[model samples]
Target chain A: MLSSNPIKKSLNWLGRQLFNQENPAAFFDPLVTPINPLWIRGFTPAQVQDIITETADTKTFVLKPSNRWSGFEAGQHVNLSVDIDGVRYTRTFSLSSTPARWAEDGTITLTIKRLPGGLVTNWMHDNLKAGTVLGLSKAFGDFLVPTSVEPLLFIAGGSGITPILSLLETLEKDHYRAPVALLYFVRTQADVIGAERLYALRQRWPAFNLQVVHSQEDSKPVYLGEQHLDTIPGIKARLCYLCGPKGLMDLASDLLGKYGISDDRIRVTFFSAPAPVFTGESGGLVTFSRSGKEVEADDGKALLELAETAKLNPKYGCRMGICHQCKCTKTSGTVVNSLTGKVSSPGEEQIQLCISVPQGPVTIEL
Target chain B: MIKLTNEQLDALAKDLDAIRDEALADLGERDAKYIRKILRLHRTLEVGGRVMMPFGFIPPVFVAAVASLGLAKILENMEIGHNVMHGQYDWMNDPALNSQTYEWDTVCTSDSWRRTHNYEHHTYTNIIGKDRDYGYAVLRLSDDQKWHPAHSLQFINYILLTVFFQWGVGLHELETEKLRSREIRLRDKLPLIKEFFQKGGRQAFKDYVFFPLLTLPVAPIVLLGNAGANLIRNLWASTVIFCGHFTEQAETFTEEECEGESKGHWYLRQISGSSNFTGGLWVHILSGHLSHQIEHHVFPDIPAHRYREMAPKVQAICEKYGITYNTGSFGRQYMTVLRKIAHYSLPDRVRLKLQAA
Candidate 1:
């Protein structure tokens, strides 16, 4: 975009000469970041304006992004980069605040659920504080409200309520009078995220209805079924938005499908990558071309781990798929992306060693 | 020199490995912050030098500009570029510091440096025929090397190497020795030569052409200032590197002796072949912490800044193992390097002494 503008392009060229090929904005980052951490280039910088505990294991980060940051749609997700123990780790989270909030006051919020062994999420809960700077990617995702003004059915499980909360608020701000019902599934009432905000929205909006289902209730744990869908009025007519764990999404989609609801009428968003499928016959010999080392790869282990086990010190960082630090040229291979479950063609391609599982005999440039 | 028992060598290896592991485990925000601080300092000096170069009509300004610029280049090549390219701070995940892709502000490309320095020199160490870094295939610094007729003027060759140190380093991967012996054809060097020219050309254009042209009327002043800075950086780098590897006490091993070397024996070879110089914090930083060359040789991929703290532990381990840990003041080590250079300029020292008797 900077290059698209002639004046900026010329200035960039001049800056390259003055700063030994580094652009002026990036070259001055050391001086600028000390004054204002948000003044960095390449990525939008945000300051943690506040940290609010939503539940025992979930926290909400109120972020004030730099003015250079473009606002996000209500249900869009953003990749947030935080430097923990000197290593920069990036993890994506859905924006749980209304776009109107960001437009009015340059602040957005990401509600994160801490998993038992989640690296970045646990680090954020334990160490991140107000005033710490973070790198942010532009918002992306299509889990947005459809253009039509039909009645809406929202089914969210646990932290999946994050994006749903943003959509509900945005719909309320737009004064949508259509009937809207939310079936929020949580382990318990205390596990609810943004409970007060949801209650407040329901109190203000007459067309909205909220239901809390305790899936882990001692007396009777409730799971989504035909009985639940039958209770909502005009369920088949209303467009449904589903955001939750994989099992919940699969169940909800199946039930909706049986109810004569077309796939076009259902929107599903996954909060995390699905587990990559690996059969017993999946793995094969992996050849590191540079080192001339041949290793037998296990079914589901990433190339990076295999390299390390074979005494090859492949360059890596953030041992997760978020950082492309361990990407290498796959000269020949059929590999599967652990994050997206996408299979690569058996030819030359670049793949992230951290996330790719070799499907067959492969050769890679180490 | 003391001959370490195999058992003692194993214990020594364990001790040094423990030191390396301890330092590695302790790597975190401190190492990242240290590198960032050095980078900032380097950029500040570079920017300051470039800005002051046009005002070089004032003699003092000219000197100050050159000094700052030279220090900046030294910091970039040593403390920042050299360490980063060693995969020292690879955990940082910053693209600027990524070892595989980081290109320093020098004539030598990072790729070539990784192959020639990190791989060949580090892996083979001071093995007589294996590590060209022993004498850089020029001056004979060890008695094991056969003397050539050209050995007489090696003192001059050493000086020339120092003055144009960057070029020498940039062209090292070309294997001029192999080319001379016709072991390798010039055609095989085409790719390397192309890389050298592209990287070297860009470096030349930046300091000599672009910056000078930008300053127009004061072009010559800017040009001269840049050249002066480069000369200073070359001289400083060459002197520090020579002291680290060519001091009198540093031993050279024949390939036969190092065959299929075990981990303990490898550690022994590294300690025997490398030297260290004691200096203050600034001196260590300016040398890219190569002042702790022994620690570096033992753990080449670990962050160089940690070498200072690891030094005493390493020395103690050496004492316990009855192995030599060659270290002294920077001046003392450098003088010994000079002495070795001068002494090796003649034929075998033992033969000369016998002739004198």
Candidate 2:
């Protein structure tokens, strides 16, 4: 999007192509930007495991659909592109793996529940299997584990744990000796995705505490108010990391502020695309000098998001980057990473931008 | 020109529901009878070693076909929903068409939608103040008229806002418009309120909240397949719709012009509003029948199935009446529309944020 005229032209051309052909790969033109455009060729159902007991309708599928070699970020998703009869279609999904996880294995574990009137996801539950090849695109998001940020707090709800799981993996890799806490909310005990894993992680590292709160469950009535996550405890101090449905994240955020958590301490990842924040130029050159990416981020998205949308392939994690995969050395001017968070370092030439809002011609090193 | 009255609207709603039911029932009967032949064909294919997959998922070769089916189903729903909802309102004179039956079906008809979608949206487009889809400070679609200080000289702010908050803005605009409309009494609109409350009320409050929340976040497979089917059909049909309106060469009249135009001028305006795509095959299957946006804009009441036979006639009449007749290749026109929408957003990409102080 930063590179307007050409990107717009390309998108226009691709949009036209999509009109003619269902799930056209033309729309997934990676050459449009330096980023690796997520290409969904096809997929095979990998594993189906039950997550929650709500009708057991929600099952997580470890998909290895035909054709596609999954390339994803922890919080990014794949668009299931399928064609039925003669019509073609595409749907977006948030990936549950970090790039490292995806690079090693071409498997995307999609935590799916039967949607009431959903199109592709509904078909996935009813018909998909090991050999069932569904259309899939490569990793198309910037959400992943932030690298080595202090006192990281991960707050999640329901099946929203997929991205957080990837973050947990990255945190383990960086081996940061900071206190990392996870507050996962679900309807019941069964809804917690990696409760045992986190428990083990908690046991291994006293700095890491795993707390699971179920709003609907009578037995473990932790975090009683289903309406507001702000009602939780110890939300301040820690650099908050959030991945779940929007409402939960919003509630977490609203509560964080209420409990005296500054906007600087909190980060949220929406289940769908979050609103656009100015990442500097409304339409101009965006140079991530260290990453060798100098392009126009004109399409009206966050510079990071534009980078992702145009497939810039920049290194970013936890899109909120409380983890700091989106951390960059701000060699020149300032960049707004988040709509609210700001970290000013005039001398060191570095900043974390999932919270750094963009202004003008800015340079960053990965 | 028939004046649109509330009684007429109610009557129209009833009639549209009846048309939908009758058409759906007829289509169902036809499908049942035709399905035997289709089954026979499938059986023949099966015997001949053709690959026939199950209802839900299938192999790769069929992926495109499956997507197409999904697109088709979606289009059929939209077409049936939209066309039966509006296009048939003029057919109240036909005694064969029944209204009482369809008025009460689930997926209640949106009178508000009729106002926004039928009356204003398509008619007003992106003319900011006039079109209720006005997005404030943060930019939404280029057509949203407001210019906030943050967006002045900061198009990325505008674009990001548009892409991210586009859906919300759309939904909000409808809700905002409906809320402000003063037409629907608060008590009578309670059913809708109740429906939304029942559907959207306790999203995380009630355990059932997961049902609708999961509708998108956790989309159900069966419903998705059906919706996929519906979406496929809709895509195919929507292609025609998007192409028809959003195509290139369609003049986007300014708010002053659009609002100021006379009824005759408005009639001519809608004529010049959209374009017709080319190719005899396209003319035959898509342009010829399934949709006639070009003709519909000129004479919205005329049935689309009658477009192919009537298009030349309509064009000739426009020529005689000194009204411009717009037509082009579908691909060409659609590309034009995209370019225009994109173009419209670029003019003030960087609005000056300060005075020369």
Taken over the whole model, the C-alpha lDDT of each candidate is 0.85, 0.47
Interface DockQ of each model: 0.31, 0.02
State the iRMSD of every prediction, in order shown. Answer: 7.4, 24.8
**What value does the lDDT take at residue A197 in candidate 1?**
95
Off by over 4 Å in 2: A1-55, A65-70, A78-91, A114-123, A127-142, A194-207, A219-237, A245-247, A258-260, A272-366, B1-357
Candidate 2: lDDT of A29?
A: 27
Error at B220, model 2, angstroms: 58
> Top DockQ: which candidate number?
1
Candidate 1 Cα misplacement greater than 4 A, ranges: A1-7, A10-24, A147-152, A174-179, A203-207, A234-239, A260-266, A272-296, A299-366, B1-6, B349-351, B354-357
Listed in order, each prediction's TM-score against the native is 0.85, 0.36
